[model samples]
Target: MSRLFGAEPAEEAPSFFLEAPRTEKALERGAAGDLRYGLASMQGWRAHMEDAHTACPQLPDRLARWAFFAVFDGHAGGTVARFCAAHLLEHVLAAEALPGADEEDAAPGAVAAALREAFLALDRRMQALSRAEGWEPAGSTAVAVLVSPRRLYFANLGDSRALLCRAAAAAFCTEEHKPGRPRERERIENAGGTVSQQRVNGSLAVSRALGDFDYKAVAWRGPTEQPVSPEPEVSELPRRPDEDEFLLLACDGVWDAFDAAGLCAFARSRLLLSGDPQEVCERVLDAGLYKGSRDNMTCILVCFPAAPGVSQEALQTECELDAYLERRVAGSYLRTGASRGAAGHPCRLKGSAWAGGREGRPGRIWPSRQASGQVAWSSLQGPFGFSRAIADSCQPAEELSPHTDYRPPRVPLGSIFLRSRRGGGQAPANNPPPRFLRPLSCQSCTRTCCRRKRVPAWWACSKAWPQSQIPASPRAEAWPASKSRAPLPPSPPREHPAVRQPPLILWEWPGLLLREA
Candidate 1:
C-alpha cells in the first residue's frame, strides 16, 4: 500500500530469487533531501515498504546528519532478512552511543558485539516462535552500513554486499567479505562447520548470519544444541573530511544482472544526466529485470552530496522576528475594553494599560508592555527603539540553581527598521505615538508596518493600479517606506501623450515630464 495521498501503483517484476540463487532490493532518498526506503519480498520478487523514513529538517546540514541503507538477501524465506531490516541499525546506533563511547573512535569491537547480541536475540526469539509455529528457522544474508560525518561502518553476513564509488574515480571499489576469506572460513570451521569451495558446510554459501540455527547445531535437534554465531565482518573506515562519494548495498539479485563493476558504472553514468538517486535506483531495477533475475531484487543507494541552503541563519532570524510582529499586530494581549476611545481618553493618550498588569500570568506576553524579549511600552513610546534597549544582553527572569541560567545568545539589534513617522520617513523621538498606540489602544509591535513593498504596474486601468499603498501618488511606484534596501521604482512609466487615463499618469508622466518640464 502506498503511503502518499495519490501514490502511483507499485509495479511488479519477475523474481530473480532463483534466477542465479540470489535476490536484490533498492532504496534511494534522492538529492532532494528526503528519507525513503524499501525491501524486496520473496514472493513475485515484489518490493515491500518494510520501513520508510522521513528527513529531519531541524538539522539542515547534511554533514551533521547521518544516512545509511541496506539490502538483505534471503534464500529460504524473507523472515531473517525482514528481522535484520528492523533491528540491525537499531543495535549499531545503540552501540555507537554506548557509555564512554568516543564519537571519533571507531569503537572497534562495538559493532561486532552489537551484531552478535542482535543476532542472538533474534535467533532466540525466532526459535521460540518457529517452535510454536512449527516452522523451521528461516535464514537471510545481510549487508549494511552506518554512516556518520567522519566515517562509515560497513558490515556484512552471508552473500549480500556493500560497494563504494569514490568521487570521479573508476572501480567496483569496496571491501568484500565472503566465505572464502581466511578469517571467515576459520570462523565457520572453529564453530564445527565445514567450508568447501567457499560454501559453508559445502552447501550454504555464507559464513556468518542470523537464523541458520539448525546448521550450527552440534546435535541437529534443538536451540541449545545448535545456534548461528551471526558475527558480521565489520569494518570501520575513518573517512577523510571530504572523501565521501556514493555507496551501494545490494543483494545478489542486482549483481546477477550487473557485475560489481557493471553496477558501479551504471550508477555513475545515470548520475551524469540527472542526480536523481531514485531514477538511478529504477535504472538498477530495470537492469536486473532485463537480466532475468528470478529472485527478489533489492538495492539501496545512499549518496551524500550536499543539502539546500536557501535561507541562511541570518534569514531565519529575520523571518522569526517577522513572525513575532504578527503576534503584536493581532493585539493578542489587549482586550476590546482596553482601547483609548472606549476608556474615554481618546485625544489625550493615557497609560491605563498597566492596570491589569499583575492580574493574569505575571510574565504574560503583552502587546503594550515588555516581557522577556517581547515588545514594550518603551519601544512603542519611541517608535524605533527595542524593548530591552540595543545595548542590553539576554538575562534570565529568575535565578534557577546557581549553576543553571536561561539566556539566549546576545542578539545584535543591528539595523531592524523601527517605525515610520511622516508618511515614509522614520518616526522621530519627539513625535506623539500613533493614534493606535494611545493609552487605551497602545500597540506594541516589533516590526515596522512600513516594511511592506508595493511595486508599480505597467498598464493602468483601475484594474491596473497597484493594490498596496504607493510611495508616489495612487498613480506611481511603491516600495517599503522603511527600507532603503530596495532601489526607487523605475522612473515614472513612459506614457504616450494621448493616454487619457489618470491612473495611467505614472506610466505616461515620465514622457510628459521629459517633453514639457
Candidate 2:
C-alpha cells in the first residue's frame, strides 16, 4: 500500500521531521570597528530547535582586541547547545591559553593550544552538569573561531563548519569530523566502537562532540581517547585584511545544503543585494530550507573591512525583477479571468497569510493599518518589496478567503537573477524560489499551515472533512489577529476511526488535496 502511494518507508524516514516547518527566524546584528556581523537561526522542519551560537565582538578587559564567534549544532536534545553558547567564551577566556595583554608577540601556536584546552574544559564541565541535572543522552557539534588583529584561530569538535572568504571566493574551511573519516574511524575502533553506514556503531553520525556521557564510559581510557572524544582540533592562520572578505560559521543544517565554494558565492551575491548582514544570513537559512534540509539551522556571518558593498545597479536590477513578477502575476489574473483561478474556481489568494498572524488561524494577520476592504501591504512586506498596486489590482475584496490555492506567478522556471554589485557581474543560474510562496489554508476548513515549503497537515482540514471524500464548505469568517505563541490544537491520532477509515493523501501539486479511497 505504501509503495503504491509512494510514501517513504517508515524506517527510512527521518526520526524528527514535522508535517510542516516553522519559517520564523531569529535575527541578531552588530558592528565593532571594521568588524560587522549578522546572525540568523531557524527551526526548519525539525521537531525542536537545537542550534545555538555565540558572538562577542570584543572580549572583556585585556582581551578586547580579539573577537570570538562560534556555532553549536545539537543532536538528541538542545540542552548541550544552549549550555555551550552561554559558557564557551568564558571557558576559553579563563583557559589562559591565549597570549596575555603584554604578549602581543606570542606565537600563533599559543592561540591554538588555548582553544584546544577550552573545548576540552567545556566538555568536562558539561559532563559534571549532565550528572547533576540528570540530562537525557545528548551532544552538540561545536565550531568556533577567534579573530585577533594578526591571525585567526579555528577550533572544532564535530561536523559543524566555519569558512573564510577571500577575494570573493572560499579561501579556507574547517574539516568535518564524521565517524567515517579514516582517522576518526581508527579512533572509534580503538575505543571499542564500530563504524557502520558512516555512523559510529551505527548510531551517532559525528565522531567527536561535547557531552554524550554514554560514549565516554571507557573507564580504562582517558576522556580524549573515548569513542566520541570531546577534544577539539585547532588550527591557526595569518590574517590577510587586504584580501579577506568575511568569515562564516554554521551548523550542518546549512552545510548540508551547500558546499564551501557555492555558499561563499551565494553569500557574496546576497551581500550585494543587501549590505545588512542579518538579511544575508536570513537568505541563507531560507535557501537551505528550499533546498530540503531537515535540521535546526543557524548561521553567523562576520564581515571584514573588505566585504562587498551594495551596488545601485544590483538594486535597480532587483527592482526590475520585482516589477516583472508583478506584471506576470497581473497577467495571470487577467488570463484566468479576474478573481478566479484557471479551473474557474474562485481564487483563494488570501493576502493576510503573507504576514505574521495567529499560527493556526487562516485569513487572520496583524494589520499595519486598518482598511475596510483591503489588507495593508506594508505589514506583509518582504525583501522583494512586492508592489501594492499589483496585489490590489489582482485581488478583489471578495476574493480573499481563508483557504489559499497558491498558484505561483507564471514566470519562467529560471527567471530569478542575482548579481554582485561589487564585481559588477551577473551570477550563475541558482536560487530558484521555493514551491509555496506563503502559508497555506486548509481547503476544507479555516485552519492554517504556516509554512512556505511544505504541504498543510491532514488535520488542518479534518474538522470539516472528518470522514468524507467530498469537499466541505470552504468559506470561513476571518478572525481578529492575536499576539500569542500558543500551540495549535492537536489533531486526531492516526489510528482514530476518522483517519484510519480513509487515509488523507497529500497530492503532488502544491496546495492541492486528495482523499484516498
Candidate 3:
C-alpha cells in the first residue's frame, strides 16, 4: 500500500540539532604600537565553521604604520569568506585612492574613498572568479577596521559590525544593512526587486554582501545600484588617545546574542579580570555559545594604549555609565519614539548640553539639559572625580553642526566661467546638481516654476564656482537663504554665447539657484 501510494518506508529520523566539535577553537595574538590585539573563532552549534578573520600587527612594508583586522561571516559556503580573509587587505593596500607610504597626512576623505573603492573592487573580482571557476553561490558579510597612527577607518557590508568602547561606554558601531530597513528596502525596490520576510526575495538574508552573483544580474545597473551590492559604507575618525579603550569586531553569530552596550560592558569586565585580550575574546565566544547562538562565532578584540592601565575605578565607572546609558536610551525610545542614533546618542543629545560649565569641579556629577530642555542625567565623571565630557574627541568638526551654511563672497561672472575650466573643465553627463540647486519638492507646479527660471546653468553646474570667481584663492560661498521660498525667475537660459540650448532647471527658491542634470 505504501509503495502504491508513492510513500517510502520511514527510517530513523536524523536529528536537526548538532553540537560543535571541540577541536575548532582557533586563537591568535599580536601587537602594533601601544595596541594589543587578540582574535578567536569557534564553530558553535553549526555543522561547519564558515567564519573567517584576519589580524595584522603591521601592514605591508611601506604601510607599516597601520594595522588591519576584519571578520567575515559566510552563508551557504565558506569559500567567499575565506577568500576575503586572505585577499581583502592586499586589495586595500593596492587601491589607487590610498596615499603612498610616505603620505603621513593624507586627507581623511581620500582615505575613506580608497577603502570604499577597494571593497567594491574586491567584490567584482570575487564575481569574476566565481564565474570563471564555476563556483556555487556563496557570499559573506564583512566588517573591517584600519588603524593608522592618527586615524581609524572602518568599512562594513552586511550585518557584521565594528564597535568602539570609549570611556567605559559603547561609543561607535557600524549600522547593519538589512532588507527590512527603510533605505535598504527602497533601494532594492528601485532596482526592480522585492523583499519578503526581512530577506531579499525570500532566499538571501542580507541586503548587501561580498559575493552572491545571482542578484547582480541586472545588466543596466551599476555595482552600487544592484539589489545585493558589495559596496561598503566607509567612515573615518581621528584616533582618540585619551579615552579610547578598545575596539570589537565580530560576526553576526556573536552579535545575535549581545548588543553593543551589553557586549562592551561584558568585555570590559573580562578584560579587567584577565588583562589578556585573548582571554577576553575566548570568554566572549563562550558567552555567545551559552546564549544559544547556532552559527559560527568569530571576534577580534583590540586594546588601545590606554586599556592596560585602566584602573579598577575606571572600569567600575564605565560599567555604571553603560548601565545608565542603557536605561536612558530605553526610556527615551518609549517616551519620544526615537530609536538610538549612531554612536550611542539617546534621542539626539546635543553637544552643548553635555559640554558643561568649566567652573564645575571634576568628579562631580551634575544634571544636563535633554532634548526637551529638561535635565536628564548627571555628567560622566572622569578618573579621580574630574568631570569628563561625553562627546567623542574624534568626532569630525563638520559633524558638530552638519547643517551649517556655507557662505561664499559675491564674485564677478568672468572668473566663475574661467574657474570652471580650470577646476576640471566641463561637468560629466551624470554629474549631480549642486546641493543648493536640487529639486525641493515633487509637486508639478514647483517643477514647472523651476524650469521657467533662468540662472547661469554653467555657474550652478560648475565644479569650481565661487573659488574660480574669487581673485587669489577665494573661499566657497555658503548660500544661507531658506530652501522653501517661492521660486525667482532669473535671466533666461542661452543668455550667454557659450551656452547654445536653453538649459533645463528643475526647481528654484529665492536665495538658491538650481538646474536639472
Which portions of model 2 miss their true places by more than 4 Å?
Answer: 1-15, 102-104, 335-517
What CA root-mean-square deviation does each model show from the true structure? 24.9, 14.2, 23.6
lDDT of 2 by residue, 1-517 (tens): 8899998777865657665567688999998868999999999778899999999988888877789999999989999999999999988998876787755677647888888888888888989888998998999999999998878888988888999999988999999898878999999999999988788888888899998889999999998899999989888788899999999999988777677877788788778878888888987776565434667899999999999999788778667755664454444323322221111111233221222112222222211122233322331132223421111011112221111111112111111111111211111223211112222322222223322212242323222211211111111211212221222432322332222111111112112221111
Better of 2 and 3 by TM-score: 2
Model 2 weakest lDDT span, ten residues long? 388-397
- Return the TM-score for each candidate structure: 0.45, 0.67, 0.58
- Angstrom error at residue 223, model 1: 11
Report the lDDT tens digits of candidate 1 across residue range 164-214: 766544323344445577877766666677777656776666656667766
lDDT (Cα atoms) of all candidates against the true structure: 0.42, 0.63, 0.60
Q: How displaced is residue 226 in candidate 2, in Å?
A: 1.2
- Top of the candidates by lDDT: 2
Candidate order by decreasing lDDT = 2, 3, 1
Candidate 1 has an lDDT of 0.42
Clashing pairs in 3: 362-385, 362-386, 363-385, 363-386, 363-387, 406-478, 407-477, 407-478, 408-477, 408-478
Instruction: Give the distance in Å from residue 424's predicted Cα in candidate 3 to where it truly belongs.
Output: 64
